[model samples]
Target chain A: MDWTKEPEESKVYPATHHFRVIGDETFDAQTLHEICKEYDLRAPVEAGNASSGGKYRSYQVSVHFPDRATHHRFHNAVKAAKGVKVVL
Target chain B: MRIAIGCALAMLALAGCVTAHIDYPLNDVKPQGRPGVAVSLELKDERYSDKHSVATFAHKTGTYNQGVEFSRNLRDYAEVFGGAGTAESWYIAPDRLYWKPSGPMEDLRDRLAEHLKRAGVLKDAFRAGMRDPAGDGGVQNPETRGVQNRGSGATLRVALKRFVALKARRPGVDTFGFFGVSAVARSREIVAVKAEWTLLDPAGRTLDNGIVEFVEDGDGSCWRAKNKPFVLNNRAARRLGDELVKALRP
Candidate 1:
């Protein structure tokens, strides 16, 4: 809608639901945090730790969304970003 | 600027390429038999590595390590549960963990179902709130009533731990020391393992208990890895679940 000559506007969705990501070293905490900040979502890694192995560190990441649509967009975008393994 | 843009695009491409394998329930089927069998599933917190600091004359050294130990105990538990045929019904919460299955659970459940089905046992697994007496012994039904009152389908809890150690020995020459020879030798070893599990009955009663112990000798490896009690915990649960189902068959 701006002077950049963009056509139709894309849909902006509300967030709901939560997702867990089990990844290798391909993606680090910093990279994931940046992505979460960009999408207005909470990474909530500490919470995941409580649920998973406490001191036995695994590359587990959990993120909360407002809805399915928002989750879908973010899921796709994150999976496509850099390093990620199993995401649920 | 162009290089930065290219890097961003590459990163995006990578994220999209990741894949996950999962299964979702497609249809509901009625399970045969009386409801007295209990299926237990449990998840436990992971143990961290031991840390110790040594102070020697104004100098200190610290050692740290971390990782999870995988276990295959779940399979054993499943074997015990699947012994009953259509005469008894097994109960467990039908979650993604139940249906889709993960590494150990997936293998354990699939194998149990296959064996149970072949043995002419295995009726149906039910979810909470959904009543189906004819399906897996309804609430009002005697069998179902007993199970409901008894509290069927719960996870068994367990705790596991691990450790590493070293040893020393006399050299072969030491054996000949009596013959005027002497020798000494030092060896490095890694010993690791820790685990414990608690069994629960259908009525949410703490029925029996089991323990898992593992010891592995390391060969001078800086990093030692072991998966015992974690695996054993699953086995214990399966065993307890199967036995409970068999014993409670009405």
Candidate 2:
């Protein structure tokens, strides 16, 4: 189970890069849109599955990142977003 | 925070084809649907499954009558460990344990993939351990040979380590000494499956790797059930899928 190889560089840019935002139940459509609004883009955010106790929720976002820098910036921003536990 | 904030970075990226297919096969597909079912057992881990054997005394041969030596483990023989039909076969090295979805386990891989997809753990799915580029078992195989979009996703594979189906008696008793131990009353087949799994990204990076082990105790059915070898293996696959899901936490 140790098949480790260097990951190929992400070349398919200007494409729909996906992210799963894991946060509390309050991380709903409004929170997502508000955080992503600074990028001047809005895409449908799919409210994903919830934890067994319903305390946490996960959302899937497929927005376009025009460049690698944008991708990294958006990833760091989401990771540091309030109430968000993990940006994967 | 100091990058890409209204800086208007120059975007001179190359134009290329892209796939925007976002069909939820788990929800859209019907019950028992077999789509892209590629589950193989050719594990990448080169370790032996039976690295840890039980008590050395458990390796005794089956005998209807043997001396009551506490030092000798009676779990290995059918005399004290009657029922469960036969012991499960553990795979060894150099065995090409590649498998394709068929028969009872036709929907196993697809279902597992969909479960992970629903959990958002995996973005793309491919055939399990068999082939990365979806090709036959021949020379010039796989996409590493310059085939486009073949090895551009995550792949998962599992290998069977052990299939223990033994029901041991606490006290080593001879067949006559251990009377009235009906196979029905006692659990027969404990389909103990030990499997190692590896999840790799598009670049062959090991995203997650772990071992999944579970035991299915004999229920009302399957007890003394004369199932073919393939049937047992199919059931093992089914159990392995569920265990895999639990082991693979995002």
Candidate 3:
């Protein structure tokens, strides 16, 4: 059995999804909070480390996804937010 | 007299090489909307100039082709995707650094809305509330208007930051000719645009914001030269719309 390749239906619902968003050093944490609030998700946005030159900032966001669709929607919203450079 | 004749001949010869035709799928695929989500779209034309000079002798006049088409396609895509519908409005602020919605802007908006409807990009449902503009040509208040009336959905604000159309022509030597008519090289036109979009909730709190850039090219052919900016800008606008939808869809 390949644990890494579990079937879609086998995955549990209402799971916690972690997202890492990278942006410029000036990226606003408040914006991320507002976005989470809009989707009615509870996520703690924590600052990570800055690039060597301090030109970029990385933040870790963990939120509860009631379904796969909600998870994708949340990811998309974060991906499109201003000042966000990358999402992982 | 001789210089004038030479210039006239040159102009005549170059005329055929000015136009090019754009080939892309204009209305092929319609995106499906996400169930229970509605989007209200406001397209703002923020270009400050109407004419761009590629060279001392070559220039192109501006139009809102890209902005209008992008808004229309977005509206259609959202509706197709199971979203409730789209409330559409446009604000044109040409030749000014700041935006002030004006009479001409309102006229242009109506013309474009009608054009989109005729192109079949807008459905009847989307057109319902848009038909009667505010007495001043502004869109009716969103709270009381079309799809926006649906509770607690997304609002998309798309601003056209920059739109430029450039044409370059290089002289060619006379070669195969019956009467010394100089052969001309085909001129190429490029259209580029920068668009910024922000997604907000019903209460006007920003959910996300981002910018996208698009550039497309067409060469001088009878079709392209005649359609120059329209062909290139239309392609770029369509591509930009697709990118925005991908970024927003679940």
Candidate 4:
């Protein structure tokens, strides 16, 4: 939590970008898993953690992009992928 | 004499007419509905020179909890979709107040751009000439939709801040004047952190503001082997974010 507590000499790793994508509740978890596999990222399923009050459980992805430029590229590609309703 | 008397009476009547009156009941006005859902996110302030341990504890608790929530829920989903390396970038100078590196900030900004672009609210998100020219173009990630024109021309820019617990209270014997307590209660330490966000429109108009607070009660028993407080906080945040996004759906 206190990231700053770490020393300055501590090497900062290559930035890992975050994306929040919204989609239909009915979308299959397995399919999402497959898509991640194709993209070379890991997909972890956490169904119970989402708010039950909302009809659908939201999914989150943390894709590794070498840099900002690559992150943009990845974002564009995901946007074009099938079954995505929206991304945030 | 008659004219003078009449004038005096008239003056008294005029004075009475203009006199202020105290109304017992107040006017009734209809309240408007809050149309949409409001969501807020904030980065904890990390001033290096914090003198108090309480402040430091509050900041760390908030950030850790938020990260866990985001990772467990959103990161999990993203990973399932092949985006496994999603995590927050943080620097804990514990000594410095604000030292978030540019790389992390840019990473977050890019992600936000990607989300907005997909939502079709990119253009209006920032005011005229205030928009990030670089981000105006589409994001480069694989899991997003290109910039679509969401023509409402209404968008929001959010300035985020971490939340801290200032006070807490429990109802005592006295109904109206009950004994109050602080967030940091003794024998059972309670810590709280807040995520404060402020939203503004593209035309430089301020629109909305909100705060999300995370509270944790100390574990005295150690019998149950409580889950790491940071991890629980993170998990909760993912739930909170998902709910927030749903509420903000345009």
TM-score of each: 0.24, 0.28, 0.24, 0.27
For candidate 4, the clash count comes to 58
Candidate ordering by lDDT (highest first): 3, 2, 4, 1
Q: Per-residue CA lDDT of candidate 3, range A1-88, in tens?
A: 2222322422334565445566664568788888888554445787754543455566766677666577667877886788876554
**Tens digits of lDDT, candidate 3, B1-250:** 3224222322322211111111111111001211111112211212212111010000011123432333334333211111211122211222101111111111222232333344443222111111212221112323222322111010111101011000001012111000000011112433333333333222223334443333333332324433221112233333444444443332
Whichever of 2 and 4 has more lDDT, that candidate is 2
| TM-score pick, better of 1 and 2 | 2
Evaluate model 4: give its TM-score.
Answer: 0.27
TM-score of chain B of each: 0.20, 0.28, 0.27, 0.23
For candidate 1, write residues B1-250 as lDDT tens digits: 3224222322321111111111101111113322211212332111111210000000001011000000122222323222211112222212111111111111222233333334322222111122233332221233212111110011111110000000001111101000000000101332222222222222223333322222222234322212111121222223333333332223
Per-candidate iRMS values, in order, are 22.3, 18.6, 21.1, 14.2
Residue A24 in candidate 1, Cα distance off native in Å = 1.7
Model 2 lDDT per residue over B219-240, tens place: 4344432321111233433444
Candidate 2 clash pair list:
none
Order by TM-score, highest first: 2, 4, 3, 1
lDDT of 3 at B89: 24
- In terms of lDDT, which candidate is strongest? 3
Identify the superior model by lDDT, candidate 2 or candidate 3. 3
